[model samples]
Target: MFALISLSDLENDFINPYDLTQRLNRFVALEYATQVVLVAVLLLGGKWFLAGLQAAMLVYLLHSWHVKQHTVDATDVFRQLPVQKKRRLIMFGSFLLFFVIITYRFIESIIHGLLTEEGRAHAKKLFQDAAASVHGY
Candidate 1:
């Protein structure tokens, strides 16, 4: 999602209010769905550290979104900000911490995958295929 936003930013596609709002809404929905799945998995796995991290992330997301929504509803302070800037502010403010946990989980999964024999075989096959393609094989 951050990558999507970054690409959109690069393309300067959030200039339109409707597009920005739509993207933000989609982001919000994705965030909620992701958190729900993470929380459920953590609960089922009984991993203390990850469960705690997910809990903290969920709380932060809820609180930040709530506050931002209220702030936007209550005042004109953000009126001068561009739609893209506002989107960035809301997104980063809400999910930056969550991203840290996400990165940690991603790295952990990659390491775990590399540790398995099947995973190593799959990776080797992928690299071999890439090499074959590069060599026009």
Candidate 2:
């Protein structure tokens, strides 16, 4: 819901309502598709919590970049409103903090995973499979 709201704000500048709706729908579809792929990757990697956090952070970062581009192209009136500016800054700051925390957690998880016996076995199998494939080529 929040994602849709942010996407709508980013797309609000379109002059045609039909075009705006189409673009929003496209974005929503694309986001869903990307998330499905991320979920598949997470499942394969077996780091559900950390990988999911990273995926969410990546999505937020992409959405923020999209919104920032639209805001940059906005008129001075849109850009200078103190209320809007404050709201945007607060939201961006909060998200940035979350992003940092998630990233730290992700790195920590990677190191922890590598230190575990099961993780080492998985890594060894992966490497062996890769080597076998290379030899086959």
Q: Please, what are the lDDT tens digits per residue for candidate 2 over residues 1-137?
A: 44334434644752444443354345545654665676578768896775666576556646755776323223443443343445446545655775697699789998899889999999899999999999886
Alpha carbon lDDT of each predicted model: 0.63, 0.58
Q: For each candidate, what TM-score against the reference? A: 0.47, 0.41
- Sliding window of 10 residues with minimal summed lDDT for model 2: 69-78
The candidate scoring highest on TM-score is: 1
State the local distance difference test value for candidate 1: 0.63
Looking at candidate 1, the ten consecutive residues that score lowest on lDDT are: 69-78
Give a tens-digit lDDT track for model 1, residues 24-56: 455666777788788889789886777786777
Clash list (residue pairs), candidate 1 = none
Tell how far residue 60 is off in model 2, in angstroms. Answer: 18
